[model samples]
Target: MQAQQFEKLSLLVDDQLDKPQSVQLLKSVRHDPALQAKLQRYALISQALKGEQAAVADLDFADKVKQQLKSEPVYLMQRKKSDDQFKKTSLAVAASLLLAVVGFYAGKMHNQVQTLAQATTTAAAEQSPAEQMNAQFKEYLQAHDNVWYVNNNAGVKSYARLASYQSR
Candidate 1:
């Protein structure tokens, strides 16, 4: 195959051909062994540039390399740039999602701490056992008038039993 035809075949394999060029190259190179060989070498070079492993062949090595250097496309360079930008965008979105989850948990913990502080402040004002006992004794004393003057032992015993029952 002519070097120029081989270059066009490379463009077709790389999907850089438009409709007219692609149809022309496809019909011309479909049964041409030399053009197929050039396309295979071009594919190998593309794979090597992309950090993929491919088997290298031994035919017309220097000529194929020179042709590849002359025929490299503008779009391949742009494809690499777009791929890098996409990766960066994906990483940024993942970082934002992680930060949102952490912020939500931090806000929940802060609200829980505030609720516990309010409960602690409320727990300080409840009535004590001694204050409750004093109030009950005062009420009992006000309701009875004859207990202070009673001197009979049997009456005192009966009155003590009545007082115990009334306290309950």
Candidate 2:
């Protein structure tokens, strides 16, 4: 009548209960028609599982299923092939974009450095002869300071003559 009695009935059909419990459950099943019917169903299920009864399958069911599978279209396989190709193309495009970006920045930085070098060369070239000579004289004075004091008045006259020559 209760769920516990039904479970005891199943265990009894499987011969899983101990001797005393089996004896008690068997006595209950002897008096209960619903329990007897349940016991019969359990026995039928056990016989079907053991391949003693053909509860569901016909003889050609496996062959029919194999034939159906063989006749089915391979749409999933075709889609996987397309997906692989798309992944490869997407990776190639991403690599190309990365390379293009690196090359673009490299070219831009090279141009900036080249422009700076050119500006420095042009600035040096545009200096007047007097300014060039003055820079050279200052460098010489720094290197030989004892000579600067020895030829102080002569150095002033020579610098004046150099400036006049540049004007000419």
Candidate 3:
């Protein structure tokens, strides 16, 4: 009754259905006049198609079609070349941008280093040799204090005692 049953009838006429399915379909067709008529139509169509052939007079039809295809303009090929060139140009631009960023950072770091060096030289020139030595010893003691707290060892305790004596 459904469209699928009609399709099954067509397949049955073509002998394409399995034996059990074919026998079942034949039993249904025997009882149903409409199914028999549909099956007859499918068989006629199959016979007509089997008798049909290409109307071309010459055997060179395939060669002619091949020649026509060869002569046709392939726009996809041109577009692909353009796309490749665009990708290359984009890659070059990206590389240039990356290099510029790296160069800028490198230049900034160099300037910072130079500024620190100038500051150190100016500070050294303003202080006496004894004052500079005292300042250096104080800085060393401060750093040693941090290490003493972290280590909490007997050697660190002795070093801390000596540092306190020197600071006093």
- TM-scores of all predicted structures: 0.30, 0.31, 0.36
Winner by TM-score between candidate 3 and candidate 1: 3
Put down candidate 2 lDDT per residue, 19-94, tens digits, no spaces. 9999988898878878777777887787877788545554457779999999998765443366888899999999
Model 3 Cα shift for residue 34 (angstroms)? 61
lDDT (tens digit, per residue) of candidate 3 on 1-168? 569889898787677889999988889988887786777677777777889533323434667999999999977544336788889999999999999999999999999999999999998999999998977776786787754534445354555356743353
**lDDT of every model, 2 decimals:** 0.75, 0.80, 0.78
Top TM-score model: 3
lDDT of 1: 0.75
Most lDDT-accurate candidate: 2
Which residue pairs clash within candidate 2? none
How many backbone collisions does model 2 have? 0
Clashes of each: 0, 0, 0
Rank candidates, TM-score, best first: 3, 2, 1
- Comparison by lDDT, 1 against 3, better one: 3
Q: After superposition, which runs of candidate 2 have C-alpha atoms over 4 Å from their true positions?
A: 1-79, 82-84, 130-168
lDDT of 1 by residue, 1-168 (tens): 487797787787678879998888877766776776777888888888889998777756877899999898755444346777889999999999999999999999999999998886665345577866765665675567543433323435455556753453
